[model samples]
Target: MKILIVEDEQEMLNNMRQSLEQELYIVEAASNFKSATEKIGVYDYDCILLDIGLPDGDGLELLKYLKKQGKDDGVIIVSAKDSLDDRLKGLDLGADDYLPKPFHMAELNARIKAVLRRRNFDGNTLVEIGNVLIDTESRIIKIADEKIILNRKEYSILMYLIANKTRLVTKTALAEHVWGDHIDQTDSFDFIYSQIKNLRKKMDKATITVEAVYGVGYKLEVE
Candidate 1:
């Protein structure tokens, strides 16, 4: 999953970023409101860890920006202020959850998972398409009730494609979600093609196909 950490506390930001990255999430950060706004304007994230306090602007305004853009990216307000009013306001402003300061990283991870499940999978950990089944929490994939092992990038690509099964997913979107900031350094989509090729071979026995749209992108076609 891709996440944005909007925090001003350098230490806290580093800690959260490191922890989330260790959990195999693509993480990006902005120490101030301006940078955060720039990122929010450009890309979509699976979840955003937003701090209500910023050096220059209120993080609540960022929530407003997201709503105005009609973006439904899941948000969790991570703030030092723990008042009931603040929590209610954040939720009212479209935040999926709230985490107070000085909380455990494990708890934060759990909250993120919960929000993702609620938002994307209708509160279910399993994602099923045709005969293929994915257990998001356990990171397992089963076809016809038989387990299949996939490399990390391959798994990420499959999950992303399944999430947008009804639409054409561009190479840029896939790279951004799977490789994160590292996509910027890539010179071509060759790496994406390689991963997709491997994933298609692994899923050959399944009732789904990843169809390439010539020079454009790919779409998941289910039988």
Candidate 2:
């Protein structure tokens, strides 16, 4: 999973990066509000650990902005504030959870897992679509009772498609969700088509169909 850590203290940020990276999570850091805002505008993160106190602006404002943009990324406030008002305000602003300073790294990790579970798997450890089952915690995908090994990008594509199953997803949406701001420099979307084709060929059951919409995009149909 990808995570963004927004904290002003350089030492604290480094510690957070080390702790999260040890758990096999891709970590990115931002020291202030401007840098955090820029990162949020570009990358697609599964979770964001934001400090409520920043050099330029309040983290709650950033949370509100993310919500306004209709981004469903999970957010957690990791600040030194432990007051009732602060926690309540952060929660009201759509924070998934709040952690005060001097927290154990293990506890933070647990909270991150819990937030991800609620956001992506409906609090279930496994995500099942038809005959395919994915263990979100284990990052394992199984098809027809057999385990299937998939590359990171392939797995991400499958998860994104399954998350919005039965909905017509445009190429631009897929690119943005997968590649974020970097998609703008790409010359063509043929690579997206190829990835979808490769994913379909790996499925054991042919019941699920990923249909193209000609000039638009693709939709996954279970008919």
TM-score of model 1 (CA atoms) = 0.57
Q: Write the per-residue lDDT of candidate 2 for residues 101-147, one digit (tens) a residue.
A: 86655456657867887987775788777878889778988877788
Task: Estimate every model's Cα lDDT from 0 to 1.
Answer: 0.86, 0.81
Best by TM-score: 1
Tens-place lDDT digits, model 1, residues 94-131? 99998888665545765786677788777478988999
lDDT of 2: 0.81
In model 1, the runs with Cα more than 4 Å from the true position are: 123-223
Q: Which 10 consecutive residues of model 2 have the lowest summed lDDT?
A: 102-111
Q: Which stretches of candidate 2 lie over 4 Å from their true place?
A: 123-223
